[model samples]
Target: MNIVILGAGEVGYHIASRLATEGNDVCVVDQDSERLQVIADAMDVRTVCGKASYPAVLKQAGAAHADLLIAVTTNDEVNMLACQVAHSLFKVPTKLARVREQDYVRHPELFGRDDLPIDKMISPEGEAAKVVMGRLNVSSAQDAREFFNGAIELVEVTVRPKGKLAGLALKELPDVMGELAVYVVAHEHNNRWRVPKGDTVLLAGDSIYVTVEKKHLDRLMKTIDLAYQTPEGRNVMMIGGGRIGYLVAKELEQAGAKVKIIEFNAERAEWLSEHLNNVVVIYGDALDRKLLEEENIDRMDDFLALTNDDENNILGSLIAKRYGVGHVVTLVNKAIYMQLMRQIGLDVTVSPRLSTVATILSHIRKGRIHGMASLADGQLEVLEAEALATSSILDIPLKDLKLPGDTVVGAIMRGNEIIIPNGSVAVKTGDHVLMVTTGESVPEVEKLFAVHLEFF
Candidate 1:
């Protein structure tokens, strides 16, 4: 596919890298020549330097023959205008724009075909909030993802240092969890992922992805040594009153949490105070130790550092940890900083760019994929895929089916019934199977979603 990406920022860079790696022709447009040069040096994709919203720039980037146009410039107006131009002039089949401003997002009607002509609107703030809420719901989970419309979930848990059940094998977990139905789909140890087998051992610091039914979620959490941060009247202190911050605070307040927000900007703080009824909105720098102490940050159940400044967010989270806060969630934007974050004792972190990238990929991939999410820094993806008629693995027990070592069938959903598959279960047509696989296994798994005329 030939794709044109507007704005060579982090989102654009990530999307470009992803598509270019998959052998798509990706051209990135940006106003910064240096950024374009940096991208050019790193990836095989083409780069053009100009205001991304300009028609001449789009034309220069081969938008006329593009299969998709992705507008992710920092400016909302630029993204909308670029999409409009791509649709009206270039006739691009798919035009997706990243719209951040609340004015544009709250009203979805403005982006219809008769109006802005944007095929899909991606909101990084909303996506990040969803991730944050997922982690917050499971206090000790490194990450959490729901699929099959909340029927199934994939929770990532890390084995604590010197904790119980640290050196146990995959086969031994069932003994620990006597009655609960759960599967360890994939895990990472020492920077390598394995499709866990009966003898696969889980060591301390290893991160395991467990897929379980939503009904047994609490049991699964407890079995894995992770307690649920139940949404019933919990206390939360949020730093940063930006778009992502406001969205999260509103949701948490509605869920019966006592929420407080510390915002640096006076106007935004006032807007938050007016817009959010139950949540307390305070005007002050989130990084200030004095302000945090004054607000009794130490007593809060959860502390979230959500400011745009990476340094401040990290520093604030460290301070919260110092204050003996049980759970601290931080937001970091730079991809380069993601590695260092885990080394610095940060258990959970969300990146808007990564979330937006996953959303964009799901939209582009399109058919038979009910839902998709990226995990373990994009090395792994848990996807809920619809099995097709005449598929190769259909009607065969899972134990006999050949699959890559880096892939595992976590669960299967057939109509109202949810099945935690063992070796005896077989996939049927129209079943939505949730599978966890590494990036290398995508091509192999794609075949299971294909239809064959011979079988039909």
Candidate 2:
């Protein structure tokens, strides 16, 4: 597929890199020549240097014959205008724009095809907030992704020293945990990722991804010694009052969590105070130890450092953990900081770029892709695709089905029921199957689910 991306920032760079790696013809356009040079030097993609919204720039980026156009410039107006121009002038088949402004996001009618012509609106802040809220909902998980309309969940838990299942082998989990309906699909040990087998032993500090029914989530967490009960009056402290932080605090407050937000900018703090109910807004910097102490940070149930600056967020989260905060979740934009923060004991780290890329890939992917998530720093992927009648893998027992290396069927969603499949279970047409595999195997997995022309 020919793809044109209208930004060269972190999100756009990652998206371009991934799509190019998958053999797509990707062209990136940015006004900054230096950014375009960086992308050109690092990947096998064409780069255009000019204003992205201009017709000449779009044509230079091959928008006329493009299969898809993705506009993710830092400016909201630029992204919207690029999408409109792509549709109006070039007739790009699919147009996606990254829109962050809440004012514009609240009004859907303003973005219809006749007006803005944006086929999909991607919000980095909103996507990051959803990730943060998912982690909060499953407190024991480092991350959680819902599928099949919340009937199934993929939860990531880091094995801790002295934990109940720290040293247990994968096959012994059922015997030890009383036949719980959970599958250990993938795990990362010593920075190596793998789809675990029966003899694979789970060690302390290993991050394991488990697929389980939504109703059994709590029980599975408890079995792994990572259960967190969200009772009334749960305390959460947010370090930044930006869009992502505000959205998360609002959702948590509505769900009965006592929330407090600290903003460095006085004007934003005042606005938050006026607009938010049941939330304490403090005009203070998160790096100030005195301010954290004054707010009794040690007593908070969770501490989230969500500022735009990666250094500040990392420092603030480390300080919160030092002060004995119950849980510390930090927003780390740079990929380099993710492993460092995890090694140093941050409870959860959310990446806006990763979330945005995953969301965009879900739409870019062929076949009946319902959702897609990148895990373990893009080394692994979990995807949800519908099994069509013409799919090659349909009607075959999972155990006997031949799949690419490092792939596992996590769950099958048929109608209202979620099935944790076994060897005897076979996927049928119209079933939404959740599967896990290495990043390199995604194309092969898509082929198995792709409808064949022979059927028609």
Candidate 3:
């Protein structure tokens, strides 16, 4: 695919590099000559130094022959205008834009007025909110993903010996979870991907990614001794009035959870109070222990440190943990900081860059794959895939079908319900299956489920 990206910022650069890595022709445009040179030198994409809203820049970047044109400039107006010009002049088939403002996203039609040309819009703030909610709903999961229009979910859970599943073997699992097929994609013990043998045993403190069929989700959870049911409304404290805080509070409020927001800027606090009637906004520095205590942070169910300052957010979350908050989540932008923070105390970390990368991969691999996520430091991937009509293993009983041990078929969502299958369970056409596999097992899984005959 020939693609043109407008913007050379973190999001744009990451998207362009990823698409280029997938063998697509990518061209990036930016107004800064220095940034353009950096992108040109590092990535395989072509770079043009000019304003994206200008027709000459679009022509210079080969937007007319582009399959997709992505407008991701920092300015929302620039992105919107670039999309409109590309659509009208270049006739690009797929036009996607990145929007940041809360009001525009809250009511897209207000700005989607007939003039703006765009097929879809991606909001990093909105995506961050979804990621936070996914963790909140599944208390046992370090990460959560929704797929196939919310039909199924993939959750990453740490195996602890205190639970009932502490001493279970691969062969014994089928006896306990007769209806569910369990695959252990990656294990931290040996630090490498290995196909599971029947004698393989699960140990405590091992992180494993699992897939649950939406219909049989309850049974699968019961067998694994995990609390699969959604958590009841819990008190959540947010430390920011920025876009991420607003969206996260909105999601929590909609889920019936009590939400409180703290902002250092009085003007932003007032705006949040006016815009979000459900959230209690307090104008105060979140870094102050006194202010956090005054807001009853000690009694909150969860604390999210989302302030722009990385150090402040990290310190605030640690303070909340010391005060006995059940869960402490912090947003860290730097990849290296994530490892350091996770090691110190924070249970989970959210990255906008990681979310953007996952989204772009999904868009580029949309044919056979529903989506892909890199987990446990790129060692494992929770992949959602669609089976083609003539796929090799179509309509075969899962037990009789041979599959790599490292890959597990988590769940099958046929329509509205989730199915946790067993040996007798047969995979039919049009059923979306979630698989947990390591990098090594991906090829075997794909070959087993190949939709078309191999020509080479």
Candidate 4:
């Protein structure tokens, strides 16, 4: 696919790198020649040094024949303008714009916004807020990825000794839980991803990736001893109330979470207090250890640092971890720092921009997958989709059907039960199926399912 990216920042960089690495014809546009040169040297793609909002600059970046154009600049105005130029001027098939401003996000039609020139809009701050909400609701989970149209959620939890699953072998999991794909994607013991086989055994402290219906999330947590006694405690402490922090705090407070927003600016803090309710606004620098300690940060069940500065969020989250905070989620927009943080053992890293862009790309690549998630650094794509009626899988028992070696059907919901079936299992009409496959086999995997299911 011919793709054009209009930003040189962290979000754009990560998207461009991933897309280019996946063998797409990628071109990047930015005003900074130094950043362009760095990206050019790193990835095999064209780099144009000019303002992306300009038509001539976009033309120079080859937007006319591009299959998709993504504008992810930090500036919301530039992103919108770039999308408009791509869609209205160049007629690019798909246009995506990054909108971080709270006003634009809440009401895109306001302020003379274009009348739907862009195909899609992404808000990294809003995306980060959703992640924070998921973590807060699912107390034991360090991270959560929802799929199957929100019917099921893939949750990441660390195994502890108190649970029935702590020392159990992989083969025994199904007997204990009764039909669930509790795959071990990554293990903290050796700090590497494990390609699961039946014989693999789980140990305490191992990071386990399991899939369960939203209704079953509690039951799954009970197996791991991570379910919260009072799920109603939704109070959240947000440090560095910047774009991400403001969005997250606002969403949480609106959803009945008592949000306490700490901002360095007195004016911003005052503004938030006046505009937001059920919120305890504080004016103080999050980097000041004394101020943070005074706020009783240790008492907060969940702590999130959403400052633009990656170092501040990382350092602050680390400190909060030491204070026995149950969940610590930080937003690191920069890809380089995120890699470093993960290597140093940061449990959960949220990049709204990257996650949003990848989501858009998944839809573009395979029309069948409306929602997709990549586990293990994009090596695997877990997709929720339907099968074609005339496809090879129709009227065939699932267990007897031959599937691609790289792909596995994680779950199929015929009427309920969220059936985790074996090879002899057969899929019926009107059934929703979830499959996990590497990127290369996505197309083939899609062909097996009958086409009666809605493609999104």
Best of the candidates, lDDT: 2
Q: Please list the C-alpha lDDT of all candidates, in the order they appear.
A: 0.86, 0.87, 0.74, 0.72
Write model 2 residue lDDT over 51-162, tens digit each, in one string. Answer: 9999999999999999899999999999999998999999998898999999999898887778889888999999999999888888768888898889998998888898
State TM-scores per candidate: 0.95, 0.96, 0.83, 0.87
Residue ranges of candidate 3 with Cα displaced over 4 Å:
32-42, 110-114, 148-151, 161-183, 186-203, 214-231, 367-381, 392-408, 414-426, 436-456
Between candidates 2 and 4, the one scoring higher on lDDT is: 2
lDDT by residue (197-255, candidate 1, tens digit) is 88988889888888889889888877766687665587899999888998899889889
- Residue 78's lDDT within candidate 2 is 95
What root-mean-square deviation over C-alphas does model 3 reach? 4.4
Question: When superposed on Cα atoms, how far off is each prediction in RMSD?
Answer: 2.8, 2.2, 4.4, 3.5
Model 4 C-alpha lDDT per residue in residues 1-456, reported as the tens digit of each score: 789999887778777877786677999999999999989999999999999899999999998898888888778898888887887778887777878777777886642335867766777767677766676667568677777667777777777676677778777877777654454433344555543556677887677667777777777776655664323556567887776677677667766766677888888888888878778889988877788788888788777887777888898888888877777788777656755665565777776765676666565555445566666455566777655566576667755677776566677767655765566677766667777766666657766753321211
Scored by lDDT, model 1 comes in at 0.86
lDDT of 3 at 273: 93
How far residue 317's Cα lies from its native spot in candidate 1, in Å, is 0.6
Better of 1 and 2 by lDDT: 2
Best by TM-score: 2
**lDDT of prediction 4:** 0.72
